[model samples]
Target chain A: MAYSNKVLDHYQHPRNVGSLDKDAADVGTGIVGAPECGDVMKLQIKVDESGRIVDAKFKTYGCGSAIASSSLATEWLKGTTVDEAMAIRNTQIVEELSLPPVKIHCSVLAEDAIKAAIADYQSKQERLREAGAPES
Target chain B: MRHVLLRLIDPFETLGLPATMDLDAATLEARYLELSRTAHPDRNAEVESDAQVAMLARAAAINDAFRTLRDPWTRAQALCERLAPGVVAATAKLSPEFLAGAMELAEAVALAERDAAEALAERIRRALAAILADIRAALTHVDARSAARLLNEARYWQKAGADLRQKLRA
Candidate 1:
């Protein structure tokens, strides 16, 4: 199936196509895979002191659609609050990328990656708060 | 007709083989040959056009079944689908740790040098063999869920292995 121009564009010149320090307290890392397709994706978000996502990066091993979905996800993640990022749905991605029905799972995987990253970040913060660490 | 339809869809049934992961190559080949002799479309060319068309379809199905049953990976997948319908869809959730490992392997392959890629491919091949053994055991124990999960993991390893091999070739 033919990929949309936007998907092709992101796939060729993916935004933030790398990784962040996963062990950092402020960085949340989400790694996900689609077993059926043998595809894996890693997404990370660095949250600032005010809970705003300051940076996002991703590396995906799959088809162009999967790469495009995560690339677009990182682009959308930056500058959004945690709640705003959580609200980013796969449907919006599908509409934006014009992904075919069969490729819809790629978007779902991207959405899952976003939620997983936020959850990781929140859990890390919770641990720091419990330890009585000074607010950064 | 119902029986024919069932045979057409199920590789084991089509090839008249038991749904076992440890299938014998010679036995499978013999079964294919025996079935092919009767189902070959050429044998139906002297019959009515409608009958010929039906035979052609059956021949195609038998060929498809042979192809699927010949590969251990595809055979196990077919068994999972047969023994536990909808299991593949329902059990699509893989463990996070496994996904992490897969991501790591994918990245490693992406960045490895030729010598490292060759070593990684060898390691992945060994990993695949181990996973296949586990899958076979799972199937033998009637643990369809474990079998399905192992098959899924094997797929990731296979992709990683393929990527490594491709890099080595480059």
Candidate 2:
């Protein structure tokens, strides 16, 4: 099936396509791959001390739907709390992008990236807690 | 059984390999390419219809075998099938712990919103790696019984990995 207009637009010109400082306490990175489709995606987020996401970025090597989903997710994540960000549903992304049934998995990937980035931030906080330092 | 027998008679024998799982993929692929070049239907345009059909069947089998052996998870499954035919009926059972872990991961993915995709993907990736490592270590054992169970577990993890990967891509 042909891609939705929104998905095509995002695929043609993605947004927030960059990286964050890996060494930074607030930065979280996630990478995932699908062997069946031979697709890979990397997502990153920068968060502030109050668990507020300041920025998001992604790099995905896959089909048009996958790229569009990542691009849309990155754009949606800015200036949101980690908790709020984690609550962003795949359904919303799919609806917004008007993705076809076959491409629903692409939206799911975007949701996965959000959780991975938050988990990374949480792990970092846990490490800081163990080290007796202020948590980011 | 018929498929196996037909495969053996028509294509597997031609590839010069036993029905066992220890076949080398690179050798098989190279041989497949060489054979396809010689007997390919495209090259035999003036050949009889029966000859073309036979070539097509052999070519398809070669491709199937090459693909099956190229992937470690599928290769392991095929090995189990060859070592103990019909064992798949009983071996499809997944351990409760594995099932639970997969369910938890699936739930995490389901709850994850668009913004948290990266964090969820990272967690799932780490979990999948650990599962794969366990399966790989289990496969190294020589015992047939244990190896069968391990192979089954490997298959489980392979499916789980695919699911997680889809979620990350979604």
Candidate 3:
């Protein structure tokens, strides 16, 4: 498949391509893969105390579309509230990247990764709250 | 009492064997030879052109079936597909811990030294062997999900192994 220059650019120079400490109180990490294609993607986010995303990072073992989708997700994730980030859909990513029908699944994987990271972060917060709760 | 369409699409059916992963290489080769002899275009030279074409197609399908059935991994994939129709068996829905481990291996593979690459490839091969053993058991029980997930993990290692080879070649 001939990728657009835009997809190629994101793939070649992916944004925020790294990891955040998943054990940290403020970091949420999401790992996902497509079994059919054997591609994996990891997306992590650092949320400030205000519950706003301060930073996002991703590392993907996938094709150009998968890499580009996660890279673009990280770029859009920064500074968005958790709710706003959750609202970000695969369609938007598809529109922004102009992904073909076949590669649309890549965008969905990216979106799922974002949600998983947020969920992980939220669960961590929940666990901490429960741990520190006063005894009944 | 299997469906006719399933029989048509089944690689084992093409090779005149039961749809089991435990088929021996000798048996497969013998069946393949037998089928090839019957379908060889040269033997059909006296037949009409259309019949010859049909034989050619059958021969091609047999070759395709054998090629896929010959590999343990490819055979596992085919078995998984048969067990779970339309299931996207190799996608990212893997467990979190496994994905993390795969990412770490992928990173290590990308920058390993020659000795390290060889060591890592060996390790991956071992891992694939273990996973394949589990997959074979899963296939026996018709546990499609477990088989699919294990096959996907093996696919990751196989790909990493291939990537390492390409890098070493470079």
Candidate 4:
């Protein structure tokens, strides 16, 4: 099936495509996949000490819809707190991108990516705390 | 649900052995070729349509069974010996830890580009292989419920591998 115009546009000229320094305590990374279509997405965020997202980036490999979903997620995540970013649902992403039913999983993958990144950040924070290091 | 009659005679049973998961691959392949010469669709083209259809179905079933049983993961799953009805529900719940690992690998793949991505992909590939091996080992001693959980975990890794492969292509 042909991708929606919005999907094609994002796929051709994706936004915020890069990685943060993973070793930085302020940066969180999330990755997700949908096995049914074999699509994978990675999302990263740089959060300030107050947990507000300072920057967002993503890379995705799949159909046009998957690329669009990750691009839209990264754009939506910037300037939001980690909590707000976590609450961004796949349904909202799908609605925003006008993704078709079959491609809905692409949006789900994007949502999962956000959660994964946040979780990773939390785990790192926990490790730092366990080590008696000052929190970033 | 549609009823499927298993009309293909059990050659292993006929040969005086129990239905087994541990068939020798080379012997099985040789036997399959021998059976195909007699029962394959191409060999039975002159037969009546209904007979030919039945023979073709039998041959196809044999091939399918052989293929499934030959693979390590699938064969381990088959050893559990539960019939088809429970297979779906039995293999659906993946562990949270496995999911987290998958998420980590996926993120790594996403950040890496071109050659760098390849290294990340290789790492994920190795991780997935290790997980699959663990699943197979677990399947050997676990009940249906636990085996299903392990199978789902394997499925997650398998999907992760597939996803990374797709990213490499992109």
- Best candidate per lDDT, number? 1
* Model 4 lDDT, residue B127, Cα: 68
Chain B structural similarity as TM-score, candidate 3: 0.88
Residue B130 of model 3 has an lDDT of 93
Candidate 1 regions off by >4 Å?
A125-136, B1-8
Per-residue CA lDDT of model 2 for A40-63, tens digit only, reads 567899988777888998877668
Ranking by DockQ: 1, 3, 4, 2
- Residue pairs in steric clash, candidate 3? A33-B91, A33-B92, A34-B90, A34-B91, A34-B92, A35-B90, A35-B91, A35-B92, A36-B90, A36-B91
- Ten-residue region with minimum lDDT total, candidate 3 chain B: B1-10
**Per-prediction CA RMSD (Å):** 3.5, 12.7, 4.0, 6.9
DockQ, candidate 4, comes to 0.12
lDDT measured at residue B103 in model 4 versus the true structure, 0 to 100: 57
As a whole number from 0 to 100, the lDDT of residue B88 in candidate 1 is 57
lDDT of 1 by residue, B1-170 (tens): 32233333888988888889888999999999999999888776789989888888888889888888888888887887787865655677787788988988888888998667667888898999999899889888888888888888888998888777777777
**Candidate 4, A1-136: lDDT as tens digits:** 9788888889999999977887788888776655444455678899888989999988775678989999998889999998888789999988888888888878888888899899988888889899999989
Residue A14 of model 1, lDDT score: 94
Clashing residue pairs, backbone N/CA/C < 3 A, model 4: A29-A117
Error of 1 at B66 (Å): 1.0
Query: Which segments of candidate 4 are over 4 A away from where they belong?
Result: A35-38, A126-135, B1-21, B25-67, B70-170
Candidate 2 runs further than 4 Å off: B1-19, B23-77, B80-170
Q: What is the TM-score of chain A in candidate 4?
A: 0.94
The Cα error of candidate 1 at residue B51, in Å, is 3.2
What are the per-model DockQ values?
A: 0.71, 0.02, 0.60, 0.12
